[model samples]
Target: MVNSTTGNRKHFIYTLAATTLFISTYYLLLPVLPLYMQGMGGSKFKIGLIMGLFSASSLFLRPLAGQASDLKGPVKIMKWTILLYFITPFFYMTHSFVLVSIAQLFYGFTIGAFTISSATVITTSVPLEKVGQAIGIHSIALILAKGLAPTLGTLVHTVWGLYPLIAITVLFSFAALLVTWRLPEIKPASKPGDITFRQVLTYRMVWVCSLVLLSVTLTFGTIMTMLPLLALERNISQYSLFFTVNTLAVVATRLFTGRQDRLTQEALIAVSLLLIFLAVMLVSGSYSLITLIIAAIIYGLGYGAVYPALSTLVVLRTPSEIRGSAFGLFTAAFDIGVTLGSVWGGFSEYLGFKTIYFLASFSPVIGLICFVVFLHGENVWNKILMRNAAK
Candidate 1:
């Protein structure tokens, strides 16, 4: 057996490198994709449809990816998925909006496959006592990449133009593929009986957790898709600064709250959602760029904490044999939420951006309400603790 600390260090290094490269490439492409579409004479509706296609594809493919990880191992699934990072960007270079949209559909599946596998790999690789901190550190890489990628991408586009930016994105993706190639394979746990997908579906906690993730991600999807448009309407084009500040805030909070997973899971989730509520409320009312930036910072703090907390909650209850499947189901739920948010957020032109943000601001509250109603009475965490005590 590998030394626990050494294994964790290796897992952290590989996961962080992969996540950073992937997120950086993703963020670099996000602000420029619509502009590229318009340059190719694509309509607003077409752009929205194309963007929504990514999430739609992921929603359908993530469960299969998870099952594959469970059967074949995460490292194997990751190897196949990461190759798409190199392939997808070549399609973007064609400058055909429709072709690019089709490519994005495949690209989304690539993301789903790798993400679910990565989640499973990391969760299983780390010790249970260190899962929260490990995930927190891993998330910081993505947040940091997100904070920096937009500004750097915009600068590259400004200086060298669109093709060059595309090239840079492709380079980042290739680098991520290389990092993933070095990841150690996780050994699958053997069990006597097999649980079908349908049986996994029977567990109410799984669905509830999935719904909670979906709701939280919906709020994020709305903000990501609409915030730039809202900023444009307000004549504030420097929206990249909002991400920078928000990421910095998240970095700080993660450093301080790295040990929070050891605390009460319910309380952490509740506090995070409450913070998200206040941030979204502030964002909806903000007419100035500075106010919007402040809102982003607060939102980042909440966003950064919620994900790892949710993952810990899910993984803590999952059997080692089906952990990959649980993660896949979780990601599928999030993809569904993101798809709905992006598609519905696109229609905000009709209802208005303010209305959309206002409605989205209440999503976390809905999730909180659901958790309270369904999962609160017995609560999965209490049951797990009791089981461990009995052992």
Candidate 2:
């Protein structure tokens, strides 16, 4: 029993390390990729497509990956997926816009698989009661990596150029692969039986969670796809500061509120969305970098709290047998949101970036309204279940 406990601890540590490394490299690539595409003579439309392409591919592939994880075990899938990830940055070194876009498709598949697998492993390995805290800590590591990566990537790109940046990214990917090597296998609880994609599709909670994820992703997609361009158009050269401030705010808030036992998932979601709405409003009204930075900080706090809360809710709501599928569906729904936001933002260039922000600002309110109307019943039921179970 002691050996089993120690092994689980080691697995958790390794999983966290692997996830952090992978996320850091992924975030580092995100801000710079559009710039790189533009430098390679790609147009804004092309850049938007390139950005959307990753999500697009992931949207389609995630279900397959999830199914595979359940069939083949998460550890096997993670091992192969991480190796695929390790090969991705090398293609970026070719400096071909078309090739780079194709590479992003592969990148998406590998990442989507790796992420679903890791989540499956973690959910299965961690104790049910501690899942929230474990996932929160895991999220913090990923967020910290995201916060630090872009700044470091920007500096690397500025000083060392594309090839060197590619080298660095590849190195980080390799590190993630190495860390994942230590993760224990997670066997699926469900045997080869009557499970069907149609059955998973029919669950109402799945759709509810998916819609919520979509709304949040739509907001983030607008920020990711347009913020730098908006800054450039307005002659605000310190655009990276917005990212830095946003990341720092997220990191700080996650640390402070992450361990709190009293903060229910619903409460976190409600507060986070309200703050996000305010931040988006601030950003839409801002004409200067200072105001934008301030808004970014607020936005970060809101966004950071959101994922952990929503993730916990989804996992807790899902049965262990189908959790992998649920997460895959969640990921796919987010991609759909990203696709919508990117396409919408692109068209909104005719209406102006501020208009895009305005639209994005209202999306979370829609999500909040939907949750209140639809998901609150589930929350009430869950509370009743807990009360009864405790007796």
- Candidate 2 to truth, TM: 0.90
Q: Native-vs-model 2 lDDT? A: 0.77
Off by over 4 Å in 1: 1-4, 190-195, 261-263, 379-391
Q: Deviation in angstroms for 382 in model 2?
A: 11
lDDT per residue for candidate 1 within 38-59, as digits (tens), equals: 6788654566677777788989
Candidate 2 lDDT by residue in tens digits, 1-391: 1114877888877887888887677678777887787788876677877788878888899987877777778888888987877667767887787778788888878877878888777777778877777767777776677677777877888888878887877888889888887776676656665456875765556777688778888877777777777777878777778878988888777766654442476788888888888898887777789998999899999988887777777787778877788778877887788777766666544778888888788988998899778765876766766786699
The list of candidate 2 runs beyond 4 A from truth reads: 1-4, 256-263, 376-391
Per-model CA lDDT versus the true structure: 0.76, 0.77
TM-score for each predicted model, relative to the true structure: 0.90, 0.90
Candidate 2 lDDT at 292 equals: 89
